[model samples]
Structures are given as C-alpha cells and as structure tokens.
Target: MTTYNPNQDAHYQILREMLIEARQARGMFQKDVAERIEKKQSHISKYEGGERKLDWIEVLQLIEIFELSEVDFLMEFQRRVFEFNESTQTKVLQNVAKNAAKKARVRAEIVRLMRENSLSFSDLAEPPIRTRRHKSNR
Candidate 1:
C-alpha cells in the first residue's frame, strides 16, 4: 500500500483551498481574519498553506467570521474533496500506466539484446560478492 503525505492528499489540500476560498468569498483578507480571530496574519497564512492545522476552535472562529452556513460549508467541502480526489487519482493512475508501458518497451529491448548476444537471463544479474573467511582457531 502507498501512503501519501498530507500535502499530497486531496483531503488536506482541498481543505486548505476551501478555507482560502471562504475567506475570499467574504471579502476578508488575512489581516481582517487575523484581527477578528485575535490571531496573527501569519497564523491565517500558515493554516491556509497547510503549515498549521486548524483545530476545532479556529474552525469555529472562521466559520463565524466567514458567516458560512454550517450545512452549506460541510456539503460544499465534501463535494470538492470528492471531485479533487477522483480527478487527481485518475491523473496519478494514468502516469503510472504510462510508466509501466515504457518499462515494458525497455524490457522488450533488453530481451532482444539478450537474444542477439546468446545470453541467458542470469547474464543480466550482477556477479556475486566473494567473502573471505578467517581461519578458525583450534
């Protein structure tokens, strides 16, 4: 199984984007949100950059400051996450498939080389290392 970092994951990425979008929708700048929430502008910037994660307290404060409906926020967030997830997943899989095809072509070339040179599959392997053994004490 593959584990992606939070930055690479659609959920966190979408959350960060949605946060910035909500703030922008309200015509609020980082300075405004910072002042209203009693935080530094860097705090707003950091959280939106995914440098800092927003806890429930900050979340509620932003929700209030943005005047976003709870139901609307949650629904829109879910929809965006789903759409981002699907599209990004498809892009990643397509790249993987292209890489697989390229590798297959390379392997075919290697096989052709082996046939021309009359070499076995073992010819592709590296030589084994030779280990020296010290004489055993009687």
Candidate 2:
C-alpha cells in the first residue's frame, strides 16, 4: 500500500493548475495539446485533473505545444506554486523590506565597530601568536 503524501499531492496540484492555466491563456484546447503531444484527450484531462503526474519529457512537450519558452513555463510554475492573495503578498513584501532594513542596520553597526577599533584587513589576515612554556625540572 502506498501512503499519501500531502507535499507531493500539493506539488502535483500546483503543476496541474499551472498547466491548465497556461493552455487556456494561450487559447489552446486540451484536444489540441493532446494532438501535439501524441496523446489522447483523456491523458490531457487526467493530467489537468491531477489524477496523473506528468514526467519531465511530457512537461517539455507541453511547453513546446503551448508555444511557451522553457523559462516562461518554469516561471509560471513557480508563480503558481508560491501564489498568494494580494493582501497576504503585500504583507510578505513588507516583512521582506523590514528584514532588509534590519540587515542594513547590522552591516552599518559592524562597519562602525571596525572603524572605531582601528581594525584593518591585515589584522584579519594575520594568525594569532602562541606563548612559549618553560620546562620544569623534576
């Protein structure tokens, strides 16, 4: 028996959605894509319905049939996989901006500390010195 994997299922679902969207966006029907890829309409339907997974070759074929460049197809796939609603996407962008600002502040602090301490690139290149120990007589 095969166990169900939610992650894998989600991945297939995203791919299926993107495939259907791309086909529709290009004003192509499933039948047309099926004919181009040498597959039956049912095969295209099954793939779009997430009942079947497309192998890499089939994906490449679909990309060609849809008249999409490989980069365009992959970019659409990525966009669908990480899609978010407008509000949520806005929040995420805001968080990213905040994080970037925080990083800039941290870098400024490091530069200030280095300057105040008179630190130089040569200091970083040199190795630490070890002290010698005297031998004791028994």
Candidate 3:
C-alpha cells in the first residue's frame, strides 16, 4: 500500500478556518455546508478543527463551497499561513499589516456602497404614524 501524508500544515488550518468563517458569516452551519458539498457534517467539523487534512480535490471543493475568488483567495491563504507559521516574527508582522490593510479596503467599499445607495439615517428610522379618523363622525 502507498503511504499518504495528510499534511495538516498551518496553511491547511488557515484555509479551513477561512472556509468556516465564510460559511458562518453567511449564517450557515456545518450541516448546511456539508449538504452543499455532499459531505458529512462530521467531515466538515473535522476539517475545520484541523484534526483531518484535506486533499487537493477537497481543497477545490472547499473553495467552491465558500464561493472564494480563486486567484486572490488561494494566494492570500498561502501568504497568511506562511507568515503565521514562519519562524521569523517579521513575517508575522507583515501578515498583520496586510490584514489591517484589507480591513480598511473593505470598510472603504462599505462606505462607498452606502453613499451610492443614498442610505441616510432616516432610511433605517421608523416612519411617523398618522392618527386614524373615526368613522363615528360620519
């Protein structure tokens, strides 16, 4: 029999966490994702917990299930994992800076959308109610 290593490296852990976070942010649970990917809930749980490793095919499945952009998603995942697990603290700082920059970009996009949609504070406020006229007056 051929030997196989699951290689549950930090990279795999980061990717797994990203997948779980994406699903959670969409109000999805492990069962929901498992159903979409045609896998068992336990499989997803194990994968997310980093107790089990994913193969190449599984990685592709995860990307699809999470609706991740192939180019940026994979690249960022690799970069963050490498930085996080690297022996050098400088790499970790670089990762932190990159993450902060990404957050700022996302916040800017949200602001742009709010402006484009003209969503003012009143948009979220409750409307005033008018008093009902009594039919007894007629």
Candidate 4:
C-alpha cells in the first residue's frame, strides 16, 4: 500500500472506482464501452471487477471512450487520493520528519568524530568494527 503498485494500492483502487463511476455517469454498460473501445465485454468486466490489471495505455483509452476530459480525470484522481489518504499522508510526513532528524544527529556525530580523531571521510568508511582478522592456521 505504501508503494503505488496498482490495484494493490488504495490510489489505484480509487482510480478504478473513478473509471467505473465515469462509465455509470455516461449511462453506458460494459458491453457498450467494450464495443467503443474495441474490446470484449469481459475485458471491461475483468479490469473493473479487479480480476485483471489495467495498464496506463488502457486507462487513457478508456478515459477517451468515456467522454471525460483526460486532464480533469487525472486531476480528480489525484484529489481523491489525497482526500482518502489524508491521515496516511500525515503519518508519512511525520515519519519523514523523524527520519530527517535522526539523520541530522548521526551526521553531526560523524563530523564531531572526524574532527576529534583528525580523520578524513574515508576513515569512517572502513570495514565493519566487528570484522575480525583470522589468525594464520599453523
């Protein structure tokens, strides 16, 4: 859900819902849409029903067939995603801020260590401290 891997994400679900809603708004059946798009009714049914994955090209094609403005469709899609995921977006922003603070602290400590030890950046990039040298097997 964090990633935009289509149908799997809420963003994609919203897009699918919009597509179905567009068809309904035009008072068109799946078969009618399929004929216009030169696809099978099952083709329309499968994507709408979530049994098949819809790609970008097909989405644009459907938007055209639905007589909806493509730009408006996309803008509306974005608006709906933001509306639905407001809480999720807030949590994501908070996590990003928290991570930025953690990174800032780590970098400050690294700079201090470099200055205290008179070490270059490469010095901090050495092998792990826990990496032990194997003794020669006699």
List of clashing residue pairs for candidate 1: none
Tens digits of per-residue lDDT for model 2 on 1-138? 999865567768877877788899999898988888788999999989877888998888887877879997788777765663444568879999999999999989877888999987687679989899999998
lDDT of each: 0.84, 0.82, 0.78, 0.87
Model 1: how far is 123 from its true place, Å?
6.9
Q: Candidate 3, overall lDDT?
A: 0.78
Against the true structure, whose TM-score is highest? 1
Q: How do the residues 38-117 of candidate 3 rate in per-residue lDDT, one tens digit apiece?
A: 88999889988988888878878767777777777778887876777565567668999999999999989877887999
**Colliding pairs, model 2:** none
Every candidate's CA RMSD: 6.3, 11.6, 19.1, 8.0
Q: Candidate 2: misplaced stretches above 4 Å?
A: 1-4, 83-138
Q: Lowest-scoring 10 consecutive residues by lDDT in candidate 2?
A: 80-89
- Which model, 1 or 4, shows the larger lDDT? 4
Per-residue lDDT of candidate 1, residues 13-127 (tens digit): 7778888998999898999999998889998889888788877677777888899887787798889877877887898999999999999999999999999999888876868
What TM-scores do the predictions have?
0.69, 0.54, 0.53, 0.58
lDDT of 2: 0.82
- The TM-score, computed over Cα atoms with residue i paired to residue i, of candidate 3 is 0.53
